[model samples]
Target chain A: MGRPLINTLRIALHLLIIRPLLRLLFGVNVVGRENLDGVDRFIMAANHNSHLDIFLLLSALPPGKTAKTHPVAARDYFEKPAWLFGIVQFLLRPIWVDRNNSGLAAIKEMQRRLDDGCSIIIFPEGTRGQAGELQDFRGGVGLIARQNPDIPVVPVYLEGPERAFPKDAAFPLPLWNHITIGPPQLIRGKSREITSALYRHLKTLADEEQAYRQRRQPEPHRPFVAAVIGIDGSGKSTLSRRVIGCFKGESCFVGDGLELFTNGEPHDAQPLTINEVRKWMGRQAKSAKNLARYKMRKLAELLLRDRLLSEVERWYRPDHIFMDGSPLLNMTAWAMLFHEEFFNAEVCSKALDILSGKDDRLKKDPIFEQFPELKALRKLNLNHLHLPDAVIFLDVDPEVSMQRIASRGEAVQAHENTEKLTKLRAAYHLVCDVLEQSRPVCRLSGDKSLEQLTQEAAAFIKKVGSGVDETD
Target chain B: MLDAEPSIYSLIVLVLLSVAQAVSLVSKGRLATPASLPVLWGLFLALAVSEWISFIAALWILAIISFCALREYLSLVDIRLEDRWGILFSYFSIPFMFYLIQIDWYGFFIVAIPVYAFLLMPVCVALGGRSRGIVFSVGALDFGLFFYVSCMGHLCYLAFFSERIAMLMIATVAAADLIHRALRNRPRALRVPLQVVVACVLFTGLAEWSAIPLNHSFALGIIIPLLVCLGRFTLKQIEDDLGIRADRLQPGRGRTIDALKSYLFIAPIVFHYLRWFLKWGAL
Candidate 1:
């Protein structure tokens, strides 16, 4: 009577209190809850990672099932500090089995639970392994399965829960995790057969999760590039931020154009300094000396940016990097602007031709005859720069672009009026003709809802990672 | 006074969304319709709100939709190495079309693409320094410009007729198209005919409630869905010509063209029909 009443209170607490908090803190997205429907009493076997998995598994099960779901744990670990055992009783109500014994107690406990209409959740690895890597399964779960061969064993895979609540963590941190539940299987074979089958099941789930994460999540082993390029006020930064929110990993949001000139300044400073930079640009047409000085400053800035990016690549080793704008796309498009700035028009045209891969004499870099610094910088090459694998170009009308820029409280440059934005928008499209020769460019409307734009950008990145065409 | 309650429409939409999300989760992302249904509605609601504010905002948005659709169309058709300038001019004409709209130059906006851009795009393609496949590339670019830019551009032009009429046209077409996509594989459920009826009823009801000054709205409500059906058919054929698959849209399928093609076939006729009839909102 005492034990049943205690179990009832434990179930109520786990269902009403603990589950909601775990869900809020972890953001545990349970995808296959319907698989648990019509399942009466069975063992849910998952790869062991952290204590969070226990709650996540309970959350995925039917609310009524949490009352009788018995998660199997070792006696030597849980019962040692009686206070932890007390907490475990309320949270998991786990069934304790002796690790040193031959396995009769586990089989008996599972049999008893099955007979009493209770389902079992057994960590076949017997203990938590390394964070992401799956450990070998023991035959203890197989022994329980053999004792009750008619009962089904459902396989599960937990993704990134260890990042929140590992064994050695000081406390649980709020993190997003995913749970994948596979179909149930009833093994009618020897203990070794059942164990290997269970291993294969978990392994398949792990492989599928890994492949999914490789494309959708970050993988430092396979770095790729994505860019959100548009005219001013086309919400390039907003789109980048949404994509970042969708998937948190080792990602770097890159910059280009005048943004690359910022030597480790805060991101919001770009709009603040634009007016001063535009003044310098307006004066360059009247003074060749100013033009030369600007060209040298530009070269030094590019070199410094390139060196910094190289060091970041070597040290930080991001899995993926997406830029708000592409350096190649913007610089090439702005070549027309460079034409009026005491710069040679032929070289500007040739640069556009070369960047577009039309004029194939990129290595012969004596085109900027009067600007030797720019020419020498081009010859040396930018070691860290590469073309984006995926491009999201948000096309907006210049009038609307001006409206958006004015509404935002950022400092507006001299060239931010309706006419210049119009010209700049045309230049972007003109240069995009060259970009389209290479990769799939996803051009979206800035007028779309942020949700739609973010989803499009995220899908574009996944397509790029898989090396598939955007249409596919 | 009695406290007011939320409408049943919100509850219905919420239930539909929950069912869609449940199905999407159960399928493990194989079927995209159940997953993307809510997003489609969200985009439509946003369009409905933004287009009501400023006609120029509507014009710019129309340009964006046309630009993306044209990009998808160009992606489907083959282009030679020399088609860069041709494609650039093709994309360039979209902004010009909307710019004409911004300045309320309906005559130039209407004739800009078909007359001048049609003749000039071939020249730009020839400027790629090669004549081989120039004709085909130019032909392809012109075809896309007509369907995506010219036809889709007429949507904002509907604003020149009447914002109410324009809004009604958009709501009907969007509703019917979404209903069609939602029920494409649901053979047991009423499909296109059901969508047509719902959209017609929806337009007629709204037109009656808003007290539209025109006599032809009731007639338009019935006519618009049929034109949308024809548009869907036309887009399907174009997709076929481009060798796009006939399968239902999967999760990874390109939704850019799929969402916009529903408007492409009917937009021009709606604009012109309303313009010829009401002669309203024209500058």
Candidate 2:
């Protein structure tokens, strides 16, 4: 035994060197470490793999307990190199046991340690097994437990040492050393009964820890938000709904802003759903107040859509959020085209600028002089519009898009004609270029058969989901 | 130097990999998983349109990475309250350093953060009228700038000089790190037990198998693993300082910083070594 000074140095070395190595190198996680509390004279039997099993179990003990809690070391393995054994003796203060002589001296030494009100960690497999598979217990631990029935046997499962430092590896990788200590168990039966009970208890802890690690493994990282954008008749509506339907349990359509454009319940303060945009587009230019009203409605719709997407982001965590239109890309594209057609300044852009706290554009334009109530909507600032992580443009030719629109047997909107659709297609192309600089925009031809388009879009989305740059 | 354009063999391999990954996921009953397919398709598109991904575009991607890493680093790691202005301005160094690289001002870009931004942070901290924790605050700020900004800027600089060398360094280092990770816990088929040595050998062999001239493959093979290990050590220390438990290296803030740490650590060291070797060879 060492003197008081040497004992303090060993504890210091363990605290300074061994702990940090476990921390910085292994990122060791100690669960149920507090379970060691109020327990004395216990045998902690753990399944063994790498050499780290001993230190990992020791390091996890309550502070000042490491010195008192000695590990049982084999004489042949530890005593061969005298210097290594000396260091291990000082650090671990382990009780040396000769395996060649089954004279039961080791059990008596362990009982002596237990009688002194100290604990011991024993790997009852006799020797380290291949990293993962647990070996048959040698019944020696059962003798130690039954001899002292009052002493509890603690079961611990060390998760990651097997992989981090496998038997054959030289350089150890930074694998986590997860230590899970279960509740203490007292076995007071025959030697075989005690051994079998201890093994079952250890196996249960191992299974629980293995199940926990499986749950905590790297979850497939995938982006949630994506937009499907194209011309009016390019099958974006049908394709996006199908896209949302593709995922099994968790998927949603984040509001086609044309219909159901309420961030909340349809109250008086909430504007009516201006489902027909072309009607307002034609009527807004007739009167300045009408244009202000149009801007007010479009701004509310986009802001509410932004609000809906955020609500979905917060409370409802879906696997995939399929946004029907992006205000930044699609609505802004419409605004740019509107400015070219009927007015000098686009309405949605002008209205959103005020929401962004830039009301000078609104005040400078003599159109909003009579309306102060609309300016107050700027208080609920949806300034940062939530753009999708990826965009899939269902690019179709103007004539084909018009034919698709006509095939629906619905009223042709002002911009649904071939000439207007041609200009809008060009406008979408320009917006795609600008948006591509940020997120991926896969331009799939929407003119394909419905099955083909659905298949292609779903594949693009899965690729985006399983595949690229979502980490950034 | 490796070719800037991907080879036919590599392209074929990438395509097969893309399809195989898709098939593997679908077979696992994730028939509707929509996020993974685009990643490989995106990779295919990048390689397919190699000429389209110019220096500016590639550098922007790297800059975005540096920006995200700096944000995560500043948020997670300690930057004292008194060092508010100092830490805030540390973010500006990313764009500033990348801008220098964009203009090809090698002299300014190389020293811009370490020499100049290094001086600026301490002064900024001093000007805040707080003396306590100024050293740690300023020191962390300086290291953060140099680590996230200056190191990433060198990769952009390497790309600007020769995209082939930059791509090879990136591809080889990334491939080696991945292979090393995949071999964890699994029995080593390669005779050597040192995963580091095994990964290095594979890195050099992979370069050779690609039929490209990897002149610094040996040097790169060694430095990448060493720097990556050191980088992980630093991240672990930062975790200690934060007193946070990152038990699993799961995909989130920790993983983002982990990838950035190793990849960024490899970049500046390899860049300077290549520059020095190139100069000596010319002489």
Candidate 3:
């Protein structure tokens, strides 16, 4: 009835009703909570992975503050039983509106609540991601947020909810899931403009989740078989196809499946640029202890080779076939997760064994050294995936690369504050510099258009593919 | 009607008291919560309840009411602080002149507040160094105070002059208040049509019996509802010109359209003419 009373009831409902359920079932883990800040109004535009997403979000909230905040719930489910609905409205005070309807009423109600300085949590995906895959998102949250530009919209990823409540099931199953909240990004502008903004926000959250998953997996001592790196908007696909085109042998698209280690349809598997890899590498320390041990894991080779073994039976493992974006670039940079001295000789021997993979010819190719700082490059002479005769590094500025990617029509998320798309572009440029100086690392100028550059690079690759006589 | 021997002291006191009331009003700004029309009617009833003191009390408070009503009019019109003295004489003083008649001072009171105050205010404002065609200041405030003090003052004089005066004022006041209420929120269903019929019959009967002449005035009252309806643009006009809508012009109450028109058009003119005629005959 009154502000204080409503606040008290909200706290009680969360403590007595919601928290216990989350602890009992999901054993919910919340991460990156230091990023949370109190603000007047905003939508928590989280990736909806499970029925557990609601509870996961509840757990992520600092105690007692959910009083003024509401998670938007679909009316069809949250309003079914009168008694349950009363309890939910009493505790959560969720802004329940008909999901089947055009969401105009909910938008109006949300606008009213926002005017009163209230916050709402919106699941941007609008439904659960099935089979551990991030689904394409809907744009209602975008529209409402666009209508009210002052509201900050935060992206939250609730990983592992389908395991808890799979689709078409009446009840939930027991499982553990982590709730990851990305930093808040506000939605501004109208209609298509806002929807594009929401789409970009969702992609960033998905990227953060992918990066988080990569850090959590066990480290292997396997050699760096392949490393794919590119800037935020750089056309990594064309470069990837050209590099793969060089090797006159069977090739399969390894993409990010090897990176994520999940057996599902891969979405947006572009190569990680230097800075993007560094960003992921920056997160590795949070992933585990003995960071050296974590870096050496053969997760990529095993996943890639296995996919090749099982899915592409027609092609035998070629003597020295080139792969595209397979071995994510910048291992020596990722090794920075452990301090420099720790990347020593014994580490190289273990890494070499992993790289050679029990093949004699694969062990003999010259190690590619892209940067002087990368100590592991000295040891990479021992190749795991039949070391390439040479390593070709396409040196593209992140800005040009990003522009190129935009030209290719990929839905890349633009950084919120910058008008010139400089932040993401700058990130791309940093990666290009890191990949600039390696052994046999041919630096291809990346400023040209994707087609022209791809054709020129293809010709260069063909020349290199045939062994030139020492006299000529 | 012009007399030179009244010491002009009477003129000065009426002028000074009107000025003081203006200063008090300008300092008070607009009413935060408007006094309800019912409360205003009750105040009028207090004046009417006693015959001997009624005229004296009405005259005593008439300057205050004119001050108040004109203050409401100026605020509703958004007159500036610099113009208060001019408004006091031009707008409020005219009403006080009529109020002076309760004590048998009529010759100077009849013309000075309305005619001379109207001519002098704009010149005084122009002398003070700002001119924005603020004739509306003189006009609106003049209209407001004249109706309350001059016209209503004459209406009050009728009762003291003749026994018929008391009954007529009571009937007019009661009828006006009732008509406002009936138009605002008539009882649900067909009662509205029935109430309208009764209002029409009662109003027609009362108009014919009243001592004041009303051919042009009552005819204007008849067309007022049509004007108010057509004057839907008044809301925009008020906002454009005055920066505030007049009380009855705000965008609500379709049924009360007729009632507001009557309050705005008829009541003031009838009362003023009555008070003037009663004093003219030395009743």
Candidate 4:
């Protein structure tokens, strides 16, 4: 069929067939579909809610036009599997945008499609909000609407989606989602007045959504011992602060547990010394036999680092510790802490003896006070604390993470620091594994807004505190 | 005819390329592959013990290099399995192409791959009776052979210029690469392939002046490919480490082509060096 027939079918399918089904199935209600002229080429800007929102909006549209409506999804998520991705692409033909990093290409593609008479459903919130209420919108939508004044920007509100299928939840609840489409607001001016006008229009539309009204004073989500995992430099530090802020508390970025202890006063008692050992190891390194020896030694050192941290954490107890490292590293450290005798005690004693001969008491003791928070040492039953109160994973890619770290200057440069980051990243899986055994842990996508994540954390705390047992 | 003076620089270039090829192979984990073993053997003969070995050994090594290089090229490109016979004939003819050029079979050398190999490939493919416009596939395959192997066979000609000149020619290509990079680094210059070509041409002349007598050719080959290798490395870095969309033109293509060209120039040079070693500088 030609474009006209396709558009006609799209509208017919949505208005006649699909809308009725969604209304029956999801109790779907459309508020302002009439405000937006069905024929005009404009962006249907909406708040992200459910994955099903794409269909919900498509069904709400007048038939024939539904075919022309394209929703933007993150490329990394959409481009994951060829079979799934291909099927989604074939059916929806979504305008895939990389949400992890703000790339100009995605914006250009969206603008190009808009120019071509196709409508894109973009969530200005950038991602789905945990609370049913309106999340703060990014300026990207503003830029697009401002850039193309002719494309009437229609604000859409999706109500009750967070309750139906909140962030990180797998299945949608039976809660009816009321969809509201606001009147098309055009950006005609260049001054601050225009920008303010656009923001006001968006806020009004967001406020008018039935879903926002349903979620009255949505409580902020929270959990204890939130593990923030990401590559180095992806505002893990900043995100941790927001998480702490969500609890109205603060966090201290304890430097790596392994590095802290080894470099401490009783450093002579360090289980593995790579530099001194390298001299002896380097001799046979050129030969194949040394490769095996070196690998074994590396494993031993890893085990040793874990043990040392456990021993050091014997003195301190924290209300909530913000580990700079990932959950996986924390677990590994815990596992090592529990495994006591694998260490060479004779070597440890000799090292300690060497330290004791030093002039200063701090020098002689060589105790690495900065230790790993071995989960084994915690008195609280992990089963009771259960799934991480929250997990704010700074989910940026390694390159972006490195760039952020490099910009932070020289405080982070520790020996084999990169290798440690890699190891800690792997350790995050341990936390995930624990999560699988319990309930759905609240995860604040580090890739998203600090405000949104903190708000999510606050909501989580309220849920847990109120004894809303959602652990399934 | 004036005898070309023997230059030590050409031998050094050959050794360096062989070393580089070895390192590249190891990095890619290709050195452990069964097919790559023959290439390693060839490299050893051509590079390590050429002084003690006969010139014919070097010829065998060149033949092996051509064989492996062709194999690697064919594997990476998605040529259909239907064109197997054509691929086989193309590979079989590489050694013969080099051999014909080696013996100065001028007339055959000129038309051997272009006219005969191209003509025979389709005839063979038609015999399989899958000839649903197999001509285009065969034609592309023949062109690939001519470009990758036949042009590469020019290494035999380098022996005539003395090992040093052949090595220097390879180095000039490297210098051209470095010049291309340095010149292309204008704060706002468009990073296009055409720009790279322009830079290479300009830098070749400069490298000839500045790098001569001090392993100029060797240095040029080294610098150019080093830049190309770095380009490929960056492309890989972007692909692996960075969350960026990689362009369609990968650095591997640049590295492979640049490497093939440098090796093509070196093969004949090393072949001639073997000859000089064999007959006390008398061909």
Candidate 5:
């Protein structure tokens, strides 16, 4: 009972205090946590650099695993008579080894610990390096590893700790550090050959970590908004789903047609029927009065959707928000459907005026005076809906879009035909030209495979979100 | 007394050269190949330190250069485990050679590596009682020490001359290299003569500007270009015999052998001229 209580207290302190403190001080990042999965009994050999290396490595372990892990610290340093040593022993539970004496007893102790199902952390370097470089591995680690051939040895690369705390410095400087864990390697042959192999493995891991760090910059903290716009059957929904799948963590999707945006999830929203779309598109504006009313009603519906989305944004502030289709795309589509030439500044202005409820044409009609709710939406200012952080316009050939829509085995809308899609594709390009004046717009070929489109979309989103292009 | 301060003119020339190299590299959209930056940095340090510090500090820099060159040579060739001690001892002899230059003990510096280092390496390897390829190992170590240490040691001996004269000789070698690189793809008949002509013109002009005598300048004009050609040919032969490309010394970079060969070839010429100027006044 007494031993269990002490172990419990030590784990609690490590998880609650020590781990958070190390992360805060060093900004430590661990790259390969998956390699340690299901690995219970193994020796972790790392390059020794600073006093902080052991702590940084320990912090990377999953909670509750620390109780079964032990670090092989030097007897001369950790066994000294001091309060710090006592705390270290209780918290870290290090196994002490004498460097000057023969390592026979230490090897036996390590084997015994491994037999008891406890993993040990050993620095093959045996001592801290001089200038943060990986030094030659001592033969003692190989001897121990060779004795227990069944127990695998995992090589780890500890970077930036020497710069943080050099051998002669009294205190550490605040610097970013990283811990890269490699796959477990089995020891083979004599001690010298094993040591050489382990040294080469550690050097390769360090070089790979250096390249990875250079390629991956810090992600931004501000919330980003991106939208996918394309003609019908241009793989907008598929591309959006794949792009969202790329983000491993928190992201939210908002807008119409949520049913089409399922990234392997069960579709919840009802799919629009062909009859409803045909009825809307076939209701040709017999006169100027009917066309004006139709435009006002569509504009009011877009504004109301924008108002609801703003409420969702306030309720849940996620890292990213992916809209299936924005109000600007819908407005452009409506203009192309009703007017002869939709790719004009006059149409753009008219769409904006109607959405803002500032158009004199809307007030002159009875449809606007009957709905006071539409007038209230005017104060909401749907201008934010027009601008996104990035726009991914998937440009597909009209014949390909028609073939894809036909193959989906669903009710196809009137606009899904090749003739209409060609015009819609042109209007989408015009929309991109206008939107890109204020935001970043990436054009991707939709005729390619699904995997290729997803990769291109994800790359564009990451580039835009990082704020790398100042022109945006 | 020698001017204790570094020559402002030499510093200005080095700065301008660095800026031009930087602009050219940037315009080409290529990085200063790994070997190019280090060679330029080493030359700048040698010139700057010889002008600012006393002769001893400059000799220490040459000692460091010899150590690095020996390291480069060993890395390129294979040495047995038992022969490591002999190779290490050869590396240790570099500082002693520079120390001889420091004390102005020219006689010992000349013989330290050729006689002592050459004899000591074979004995150390023989002490291990391994006779297989013993001759080859001893020969490789002796040649490395002789070429990288003893031959390069002559550059330290040249520090006794006026800084202006030393800088001018180094610049002449650099001019020869530029001419060689610019005309590398031309016919041998056209390339070799043009290299010599450009090198002679640059050397003569710089020597006259530094107030060197006309005869001495003319002799240097003839000797420096010939040495440059010989050094290039020797390095080419070594590369061919070893089946190693020059760029393999540093990946993602052009060949560094040209700069190294220039340093090796200019050392003896500068040393001879220093001896003449000090012992018999200007030639």
Candidate 6:
């Protein structure tokens, strides 16, 4: 009778004073409350990071449920002097355990408590993580969980507690904290399997909490752009559409003239007429002066396109910009069509110098004078050019790309010839080298199914956006 | 009634065994293989203490020893979950068996575990279900009851002998174990003969020194050593069947299986001495 009165008073003190005080001071945010909707009694297995983790978890629970839960604490630490023991017992009602000895006595006591309708909160790592990382769960959790197969094991991940009060700290610092509750995992197998399942479940909750934290924190105001560069038949437009779908209305695609004119629909670019390309080739073959004129006109057009795209990027201030067929890749293909050895370092340096406006030869040429827009584009360089923050380079074999293009029933372009495509494929490597100097480039195999490629691209974008790789 | 005077012969045997263990520890850096030392100490302590205590005290001490040995046995064997209650019951029966010895109820003590526990444990297990491994569980529990409880119950029967002869019986068993330990590594054909000869000579010599009559000494010589040899052989076979290794070299660090076998072997030889003492009083 006396014990019940004391316990009830303790419960009232915890519910009325301690929980509210901790929450008010710490600004505790709890996510995944729906995971605990139907659960009344369960073993809450969590990562051990700080002394305050248990208190934070208790605060997250409803006031009525506190009386039926017990935390399993080490006997060596909790059962010291009379005053400390009374305080620990009143606040937590811990099941004291000796870790050095055989665990049979502790196990029997825990089983008895469970039979009496008390749920348990166990730190499966058995000790606090001194470095603020999760440790592997000990096997005792599995042993107990297996013995009571009917009880649901709810995995909870606690963040910010380690920063608030780390292993040897005397007092907690003021910090905003979070507790993410994951769905219950009911597993039956060997002890190893049970431990593994618990670890993986808790790890997922940690990842989710981390992602939520990143979403809440403010990011720098820089527009992120990703370009999809590949051969015409390498499914670049298909992958671009899928990448756009991954953004889910958070971004816009600045497509080429064909995709823009089609209002974001899939359509083949208007193929270059063979008679026009033959006439141009005949003019080049007639005299060197005609060839020089055609080359200068082509360079001027590329410079104008780069300047216009830069303006489009600034207009979409913070939203991600994904370009479908950029002028940079088209210029590389054009260069490859005329030069057989298009990948030579000398040829690459000359192209980079002309594109970056560092070459005095381009300034002295009459083409810039003929078009004043070309003079305005001289500010475009390798550094300021609208290259992607990261490139998702979809690489496919030439034969496969050609087969896909042939099946599309669209007219072939001047550069879609087998001989030109072989050179263009090699030339895409040099373009990637130039792009690598500016931003991150991720090469993905273009031969995968559409669903596989989308998932991969979505994962890559999420990783980049969150600024932390969850898989690691 | 058993005499209460401290047996000088028992004291002398204890001193001898202690000195031998000390020498072995010094020379070989161990008393015996790590798996045999606990059994050796258990036998030494039981014999050494029972020689000085009252009959009831001696019975209680032996009862506790038998209970611990039974626990060791049950831990090594695979008993079903349902049979745990029966094992607890078997554990409780140890005190009752020794209680019968304390009250001098010899008739009931002899048959209590063998007849009653053997039949009742299977019933306890069967009530759970006729589930998987029923036969194996029943057989293993019965085997544990027979060896650990019934056979070890004979230690309490030693209350019938005078303290001197009772202590002498324990000493002879210890000597037999020592002899087996010494010659365990010899070729099989040579090892048995050597153990038989050495154990016979040692026990006979000790019995004569303890001033037993010649015929009883001769009987003690032959029967005690043969029982020790048989006990060692049975333990080896069981250890092999259970896949327990006995190759550890640290003293006092033995497995449960070795402790079980040692108690099983020594208890019956002590029972035989009781039989002899009852048939012919105090030689």
TM-score of predicted chain A against the true chain A, for each candidate:
0.46, 0.45, 0.43, 0.43, 0.44, 0.46
Which of 4 and 5 is the better model by TM-score?
5
Q: Candidate 1: which stretches are off by over 4 Å?
A: A19-40, A75-82, A97-117, A159-181, A209-211, A214-472, B1-283
| Per-residue accuracy of model 1 over B134-226 as CA lDDT, tens digit each | 666777888888988888668766654444555556667767867776677887246666766776677666764434543576677667777
lDDT agreement of model 3 with the native: 0.49
Worst 10 residues of 5 chain B by lDDT: B249-258
Tens digits of per-residue lDDT for model 2 on A1-472?
A: 6598887887887888998877754656777877888886679999898888888887888768878888888988888688998888878888788988882999999989998988998998888887666789997899988888888999888777776566655545444567889999987889999999988988888876554221212333343788888877787877877666565545656545322212211212223334334335434432334334545455555655666666555444556778776755555565545554432334434543454354554555532342333344433444456667789988988888778777888655444567767767777776677667657788988657888888888888888876654554
lDDT, candidate 6, A20-132, per-residue tens? 87765454667776787778778899888888888888888877778888988888877678899888887898887898888788788888889998889999999897544
Give the distance in Å from residue A14's predicted Cα in candidate 3 to where it truly belongs.
0.9
> Which candidate has the top score in TM-score?
5
True contacts kept of each: 0.00, 0.00, 0.00, 0.00, 0.00, 0.00
Q: In model 3, which regions exceed 4 Å deviation?
A: A1-7, A168-174, A211-472, B1-283
Q: lDDT score of model 4?
A: 0.51
Q: Model 3, range B167-226, lDDT digits (tens) per residue?
A: 443334335445545565654344334433444444455554433345533443343333
lDDT of 3 by residue, A1-472 (tens): 5988877766886787778876653456666676676755667877776566776787777774566678888888867689988877776777877877888888888888888877788876676656456666676776787777777777777665654555654455333455767777765677567667766766776675444121212322121222333433445555655555444443433443222111222223333343244335434432435424444443333334433422222233222333443332333223323343444433443343344353344333332232232334335432343333344455556556556656856444322123333433333233334333332344556677667766665565556444432312
Q: Model 6, B71: alpha-carbon shift in Å?
A: 0.8
lDDT tens digits by residue: candidate 5, B23-64? 757775364443445565566567677787666676787777
**Candidate 6 docking quality: incorrect, acceptable, medium or high:** incorrect
lDDT of 4 at A260: 21
Write the residue-wise lDDT of candidate 1 on A1-472 in tens digits. Answer: 5988887788788888878877654456665777777888888999888988888888878888888788998878888698998888767767888888777877887788789998999999889988778899988888888878888999999875665566665455444556889888899899889989999999998986665231112323434667777788888886776676655456665544322212222233223243344335434422334434545454344334334444445554555666766655666555545543533444545554554345545555665654443455455653234456677788888888888998988667545678767767767775565567667887887778889988988887776766643333
For each candidate in turn, the TM-score is 0.35, 0.34, 0.29, 0.29, 0.40, 0.39
DockQ of 1: 0.01
True contacts kept of 2: 0.00
Number of clashing pairs per prediction, in order: 0, 18, 29, 40, 0, 0
TM-score of 3: 0.29
